[model samples]
Target: MQQRVLWSAVMVAALVLAGCGSAARPASPSGGPQQEQRKLVVWDWKSGEAATATYVEKVKADFAGRHPGVTVEFVAQPFDQYYTLLGTAAQSRKGPDVMLFNGGGQIRDRVDSLLPLEQHVAQDRSRLAGWDAFTKDGKIYAAPVTLQGHPIYYNKTLYEKAGLDPANPPRTWDEFVRACSAVKKATGAACLALGNKEGFGIQFFMSGLGSGILTPQEYDDWIAGKRDWSSPHVRRIFELWKEAGDKGLNSDGANSTAMFTDVFRVFESGKAAHIIGLMSDVGHWKDFGEFLPPDKLGVMRAPVVTGGATPSLPYDGGIGYAVARWTKDPELAADLVHSLTSADALAAFSSAAGAISSDTTIDVSRAGPAVAAIVPEIRTGRPALHVALSAKTLDLMGRLSQQLLSGSATVDKAVEQLAAADRAG
Candidate 1:
């Protein structure tokens, strides 16, 4: 996607011992064999999932073709602690040969322990979409697997029940509010499904609605590192977040709800009319399509909140695999990374896991119309606003967002704190 909407890799680093699976032991005294077979250890969150089994098998088969006797062990780590565990492994200098990471600050903050893959992945520059997320100082670190975005996902059946046209979604902020009100009155569904126990709701809200608030030039400038956290439009984002919670748009107990689990269920079960959700993996078209009928799953653009505002997809790299600096064979490890993002492998990932693969060549038409609507928007999509912030700044933003939702912080206060945090970077 280039500057248009570069897909980046969100690597959830996995750690496996170097010696635990290594084949570097000296030849046996008997000369029956020179040494045990080579083994490559990899860490990722998706390896253990049934949905991505085909993807894992594809990469394993591809790598085995290149190196017959080498064993590949994949250890799946819980995402909530993936980075923390990877940190401990990095300090010990005995991390796995390969690991996964989230694109943006998640990968950018830890580049010191990663290998630059530019030379090894040159052949994939034209094939993949999200390289920039894992890149730093003009060097690439990981290959992106999925292009993640925040699109306003709605339940079409709810819209229809509210006497609103499913095909003609709201276009303006006032209109959106009116439509949401209609849904609430007619169907008793919450206007929106939200959870902030992890404080991800603000990230989704900001990115999903940012395009319709910031001008195109302003948006690009923010991505280019000229962020104005104190801008009125930026403050408005926080205001809207607070307003949604206060005005009963969001479901009850939003503060304690886990977005990764409960919030999606609310939307899927027809309790909520809309959610600012992902374009890949869980909480996306595929998950909703599985629950609701495919035709009832709708992807809507951000409503126009300000005059002259234009809406577009907000996304970055989802997750990607990167080679660790301590790996014994950089070339062999890079080969594994290459095989992981290969067309066949990624195609399987897209088909089985419902990921928006970074390999744009993979056809997603069969997945449903929602996927069809999303794929075309990447060309004009902006980098996710939340992804553009530094790690510390984003953490602060999350806390401040939670405070705002809980009535402990005002929009101005939240923006001011974010401005200072961002400036400190």
Candidate 2:
């Protein structure tokens, strides 16, 4: 199948305690005849899912082998409530020994309650590439497990039906619109599948299409904490969002569509030609490959909207594991964190869960051409624009995007709100 174009631990108990500040170790008593069993509680949303069972087991097995007296217990929580639970635990100064986090704002915002893993995972640093997302204030707080980004995935079969060359997908905004018009005219399929009900649709649109509209300097600056939401190029992205809806480029009821599976299903069922999708998890090449044949899948850069906008992949750390600051044994917990990210463990995850492992050493050539095309782009990739936004701003953007599509809000108004929010943070 050839689909072209597309896309650490730990220290001694005493040393860790000193590094992490005072924390009690209930498992190890001051004077006991026999040492009590050590249990390291891990919090994450993925372990309960069947897809990652093997990966979790591999990590547990490895950690158990290294630390005979410790037992690892994974507490799977609903992702929607995971952060809330973590926040509660943080306030109480007690929680799981280890916790899983999505890179970017999620982890960055919560670093105050996490132990810095830089010194502990120094050996693994060179083997990983997504450290930026999990880093804050020059300190690394978590170890990345997957690489996530928004990539434009298209259907070659749809392209062919539209009379467009599959190998030559659109490279510019004008060309993309023409191609979409052709697609709608020939096959009657929507040009793009969008699910904004949760507002993630806007986020994906902003990141996926941003590379084409913003210049390289603008893109870099946005992620570097110097966002210019009022820039004409930046404003253009929001305009396109409304334009896509106004032009009927997206499937019907887009504002009510859920991004997780609804938007993907639209594309999967051949109702739409393209989607702004993830790299590692659901809605990615692997998931799409199930419905569309390898040769029918294509990955593309964001179509160039403004001139001089060099197309570069936009991505950052997908998901990672961080040690809770109030753990009884920081060293032991950090060791488990390192074990979870071990090459062998990540390899199992990549194979079983179809994840794009954070370990750069992991072999992925066998995954397919779509992944092949996406991986190399990392060298020129910049962090996603939305990842830099605070959660509050993202929530606001989602609502504003819906308004834009509905003609209730203009680009100027949306940008004004975003600029205010971004500047506030």
Candidate 3:
């Protein structure tokens, strides 16, 4: 499944031992026979899910083959309960040797439990795309493994049926809205398949819009309570969403739809013309093969809102590998992370998962034409809102977006609620 990237800012305020300084090394494995029988445990939310277990098994087999002396224990955590289980285990100092750290709230709040990987990173800088998202106060805590950037996925047949030139996709917000409206009018297909059933979907849309519509400093100010959520930029985004809802351009049953299955199905069935999702979706075209013809399926950058100061920078999200601070074998943990994220491993993983690697050394062309076309956008230096805000602030914004989308609250009311939530936190 293609993962959605949200735009909540994750601020790093806590201080920790910098990798440049001498911190006591973790105790090595016991000597002799015990050392030779080392084992590493990994808890991954992505691997355990029914939808992705097959891919997980492949990763496990590959890792085991690469390290004959090492035994890998793979544990899958349900998406809804993964964090809670991780938190409980982390507090007990019994967390997995290596774990998958997500981009936003989870990483922000649990970073203190993670070991700094700057030492490992310095030795193998090629494993990461950029240190900004995984670094804190000059210390790198995680090694980014995959790159998932937001992009527009449109069905070609729907475009043509709506009188749009399938060869030409919209490049601006005005053109995008007009094209979507046209698709709705001509074919009665939803212009865009958006699932609001889970608040994450709405948050993802906000992040994509926030990326191009707000300045980095403005985002920081919003998170710091220096600026109000009722500002024109924030209001404009919500207004656009409201407009989309009114135009019947959004997925049917959006209020109650399951994001990956139901919402994406609209596009897959040719009942929707477009979807704004991770670039990874371009690789998993088989799921929506019926609706998207090979030649007609179009991939493009997310449209920039008119009058926005920032250029189009898509929201990025994916999992990174982080070692536990309390691990008994830090070097082995680092080695595992490095091996999994190595250029060779990345190529294999990307091939299996249909994902893009963060490693700059890898030739993205290996992922095929569709993914190759989208790599440049992922590498753009636009700031991610999720990488910029405090964890608590991000949670508040996500809840506020949900309230607005559900009609349980007005945009202005939601903004006021966010202000209160920010102050309370």
Off by over 4 Å in 2: 1-37
lDDT per residue as tens, model 1, 113-208? 888899999999998887778888898999999999899999999999999999999999999999999999999999889988888878888899
**Tens-digit lDDT track for model 3 on 300-344?**
666767554555545444678888876777778887787667666
Ranking by TM-score: 2, 1, 3
Q: Model 1's lDDT to the true fold?
A: 0.87
Measured on C-alpha atoms, candidate 3 has an lDDT of: 0.66
Which 10-residue span in candidate 1 carries the lowest summed lDDT?
A: 24-33
Those runs of model 1 whose alpha carbons end farther than 4 Å from true positions after fitting are: 1-37
Query: TM-score for model 1?
Result: 0.89
Better of 1 and 3 by lDDT: 1
Q: Assess candidate 2 and give its lDDT.
A: 0.87
Evaluated at residue 219, the lDDT of candidate 1 is: 86
